[model samples]
Target: MQMSQIVTNFFDACVFFPRIIFFSGLLSLSGCSNAVEFVQIFTGNNGPTGPNLYHFENKEQLDLSWVKSAMSRSDYEKVLSRIDFKRQVLIAVSVGERDSVSENVQISRISLVPVADDTIVDVSVRVGMVSKECEKNLTSYVFVLGTFEKPKKTLSYGGFDMDNFNAGCIAELSGQPNGP
Candidate 1:
């Protein structure tokens, strides 16, 4: 092939490859944009002892509620003060009781998807595995989120990990020859 033809082909190849890569990158980022951003107000294993999801719209609601029963009054007030109830809300996820204190809960991702006239808040959580038997303990996590509006309008869920933990753990234990 001629040198001119070869140079032309090389330039065209460079331009074509970058466009393809740029477009694909944009496509991938578009999918990730639905993940809602949240500021973690507090997260600890000492939350409510049972699986619970709390969504509070204002400080008055939180102040009058028992959701912070597991937390100190001062600490609860501190968390409440950080929130501007008019602009943000609080979401707490309690993983309930686990077999060991070593076990932990992680709020991996929070996403919002529009459905009909409302939105669905999907929370992705993961908990550490307890390899051995231990005293039952409370495991929980909390986050402060700022949505377009209060989260009362959104349908929320504990996501897959909270829903499937028991079944998955049982399957794993039963499948082993000698499980913990």
Candidate 2:
């Protein structure tokens, strides 16, 4: 074969090899895109009826009146103690019918992971099937800095099944500065 023809063939082979490898690598990573997903968080009497159901800095300030009552303080404290604020916390909330499984299946997988220089919190809330089907399965979540306070009861709304709904919050407290 002529020298020019041999050189041309060599260049073509080199270009084709890298292009094949690059495309296969991209395909593998694309399948893992759903590894983590985002879910909206809401709080108030009506559960995102309007702008009122936005994020809140203070949990107590939340109009949880719509919610029967939060989980017991002792239980919350126990969970908090087990968590490491130095690392990001993953919180998952899943809602389902009182007796059915076709509920907040998506939000149930919420999780938290600590990234360099920052703590990441993951939350998922699922509203289950109820008379208000659309509103029932709605889910939301929030991530904040610092540990959460135990929920305290401030009033009573008789007959509501507070436990029926599931909610989770995760946050990492900022590190303290070194000694002076």
Q: Rate the local accuracy (lDDT) of all candidates.
A: 0.48, 0.27
Cα lDDT tens digits for candidate 1, 1-180: 999999887654432211111231242121211455676665544544455556677777766655556466787777767778787766666655544333334567666544333444556665555444432433333222222345545553323235323322221110101100
Q: For model 1, which pairs clash?
A: none
- Compute the lDDT of residue 82 as modeled in candidate 2: 48
**Best of the candidates, lDDT:** 1
Q: Positional deviation of 56 in candidate 2, in angstroms? A: 12
Return the top candidate by TM-score: 1
Q: Which lDDT tens digits does candidate 2 get at residues 1-180?
A: 999999877654432211111231232211110113333232112111111111222334332432212323564454344444333221322121122222232334322222222222333333332333323332332111122221222111100011224322221111111110
lDDT of 2 at 97: 15
